[model samples]
Target: MFQDKGALISLPAADIAKVRVPGSIFPAQELLALELREDLKAAVRLIKDICEDHGVDSLVVARPEMFTNGPTTAWLHNRIGGIEDHICISDGRTVRVVPGMTNHAFFMRLGVEKNFERFVKLQKRCPELIRGLASQINSAFTFPADASIPTVILQPAEGLMNLDPAFLPFCLVRHSVQATFDQIALSGKIDLTENFSRCSRLIYVPLSEIALQSEGFCRYIAREIAAAFFDPTVGVILALPTAETAESDMKAGIETLVEALRGIPGGIPSVASHRIVLASQECPESFLFQGSRRVELVLHNSLDAWLHPPEYYGRFDHIVVAASRATDTRELYVEYIDHLLGRRPEFYWLEHLALHPNDTGLIAAW
Candidate 1:
């Protein structure tokens, strides 16, 4: 069943079902011929066993998280904490089981130093690494060969772990494109198309701290780009605070987001509550509105505000455009990076962005 110059990339064969999955590449065709998830695992095992029974060396398995979860619907995001994926390697003498991280580690070998701070746009920042990650997952649930089982017992026994902070951010980044489109739908001021690529159109611009940042101008810039590239409907998602956010020594995060978002053309701004105290009792979807037309807030509660789940973040197309609202650029930059790293995305489809502290509303976004 082997051929030359095909999409399926095979590695050296090994004896006993011992399979070694490569990180960046995997056997996609072999898995898909089978239609069931559980059967998919069995097919993988069968292939490995066939190679092993033939006295082959071992099965090289390359995996990714995207395959397993890409088809997954927006839910509690099971990837948060549990065995989302796994690979079973069995040699005539033994079977070794491994989790998805093994594949991440595989890609990491050829991986570049990803300083999330430096990545202004997700894909623009690191596409190959990300693509490799997604491909692995796709390979996981590949269709099984015909006659595959239809039960969970045959699924790969990859032990799961609590979803990694890095995992959620990465997932959110994947959905960033969708979030942008959704933002347009919710704002209602723009008629944006649903098709968008994460980072392909959106870019993060971090700047120095400055008081009186005018987000109004920032929206104009984002609109100009959207109109020029895709459509005038192209919208921006920002996370900044009110300029008057008065906390000299301490950072006023939500307030800053309010200001940056306000800078956008027809952007609605709101305060994120703190200390388990909701700034409102509704989600941003309820309070956020187009222009000064404020909608009824549905999730201003302190608890939800504090949680600020990642799904909510994905519900809109926005950028992490921060203005320090700080008088000093140097100090603001330091605090800004610190906050970006400290705050992981509440949803799997969004990632933290690095914005400047001194940037005035519009100026900072640029």
Candidate 2:
């Protein structure tokens, strides 16, 4: 995770039962609510239980380009360390070990439009599939109704492939599938060989631009739309960095984000979220009082500004916010929440789904 222009610290080994690394997960969108380290461990335990109950050979894992080089990757690959049986694609083979993770370089694999499109085309040919698998390893996934997809990932060349516009449809779709792969599966093939390509900019929808009046289940898009789609509500956590360096970087983060998310309908504009940075910062509990005001807030948790709480906090009951392994040292996280819940669950609830665009072949450096 790049915070204030640098890397976060990796923590020592934890006693937790399991640690799940989602492919290309954005903290602002998918963190657990305030809770203890035990809570996170418990979630992982359930995943393990279900896998074992079903006589599963292994639980599929995935990561995308977005999460590749960030703080989360460092933590999973190096910091707390991986489980002995954890299967991560490494150096052309599936390695079921944790200690040597750093050697292969870490990544959250994704099943994006391009990857899937490519995989299907080659499914009929055994030799081509084997050749491609030798160079690039992959696994299958499915998701729930209006839920995000799940995926299994391995190592990539660069830490990650950063999309210039920031909003990556391929990355998004891959995330949705990875998140829900355990629950749902599509019925037919998505053939986009002619209209779109992984190398292309955007995936073309088969239908014309039909104005969507009703809310569909897409969290990332819905998040931006929260401002216009429903009544956009946001929560902001303002604090000054204890260190001079971090303070400057955090200020830039605010400015950059405000600038990037300028004119989208249902989006939480900058004027709404205030900027409050000071020399003295308070504890997470002290900031909790302001929770009811906005849907989400972003905070700085560098060594200079640390959050000393028993666990991570989230925006609504549906979401979870936890520190990335990177935070073990810096100890921090950030988010954008949605306020209106039960009142209008459709508009307010963030189901954490993704939109997989058409994919390209063997990308992000195998």
Candidate 3:
């Protein structure tokens, strides 16, 4: 029932002091003249007259600290407005504001039962739960024989070109959830490719040229891995980028691609068939499983693992099983990796399925 332009224009305190007169701004004459404007209505009329005379748009008053007396306290408790109207007068012309935290606490105290019931409704209606609902609705998901876990690679494509590609995955997760909430329900298909593809950084070079640079090559691999993850129709594809690209450009592409897949609400089971690959060269042989890469970084602090994963493992059971089985937390996982095999082996794959519950759920019951 309360509606306006919904924009607040703030005038500085200095400007307010220059224009306002203490008590004369109120509609004392009009309130006395009009019989109908009594009690709470009289305060509303006073606020309107002040807005008209003093050009006072909106005023946000912070509460004075405990055991302190100030002009603000007197102005607030002087009964110029109604206790029911939050000790403020509002007739669309002006709003006498109070500290939001104080207002919230006061209202919560007055309507505890109503507020509690509304909180329960909020939990049930949370938009993030749409992901869970989407998960429940789409039950058709299966795993490949080797049980390689599905992964989504996200990269910056267009508008997201400015953002670090590595961050795009988390952004995709958040944005897709938001989109689901906006629509009030999950759709059969969620597309976010166009929005992510916009970027200022792009380059053109031959595939062979890019392969010469290891960093650029690794980045290209990240992009290919991201693209392959989202193409539900194809389990894997080995195609060289016709043009050479910067590591950042390739990363940007991967960021957007992965974000699109990650944003899919309820989860896209089709991604399960795809195994992530970031090899320098595309092996000519067509195969589902050739090998996977495991990256290990040694950091003194646990902060890096949370903020920036030492190695971003895209749910590879082969890699995760060994890591998860060895440690309870990510910090421990890093430590376990550090302690393993003083002499690093040519192939990092391990044979143990130590069988974590979440891992077991991912696999088909034998």
Estimate candidate 2's alpha-carbon lDDT, on a 0 to 1 scale: 0.23
| Model 1 regions lying over 4 Å from their true place | 1-122, 135-251, 261-366
Give lDDT tens digits, candidate 3, residues 1-366: 001111111211222333333332233233333322122222333333334454433222322122134665455445333221222221112222333211211011101122223323433454232221111100111223232222111111111111111111111233444442233223223222322233221111112221212232233333434453455322222222212112324343333333333433333332212132222222221121223422222111101111112222222222211211212234433333333322222221121243421222112210
**Model 2's TM-score against the true structure:** 0.23
For model 3, what is the error of residue 286's alpha carbon versus the real structure, in angstroms, after optimal superposition?
41
TM-score of each: 0.19, 0.23, 0.16
lDDT: which candidate is best? 1
State the RMSD for candidate 3: 24.5
Q: How accurate is candidate 3 locally (lDDT)?
A: 0.25
lDDT per residue (tens digit) for residues 217-242 in model 1: 34433343334243322223322221
lDDT of 2 by residue, 172-252 (tens): 122233332222123122222221221112111100000011122122333533333222132222222121121234333
Q: What's every prediction's RMSD, in angstroms?
A: 20.8, 21.0, 24.5
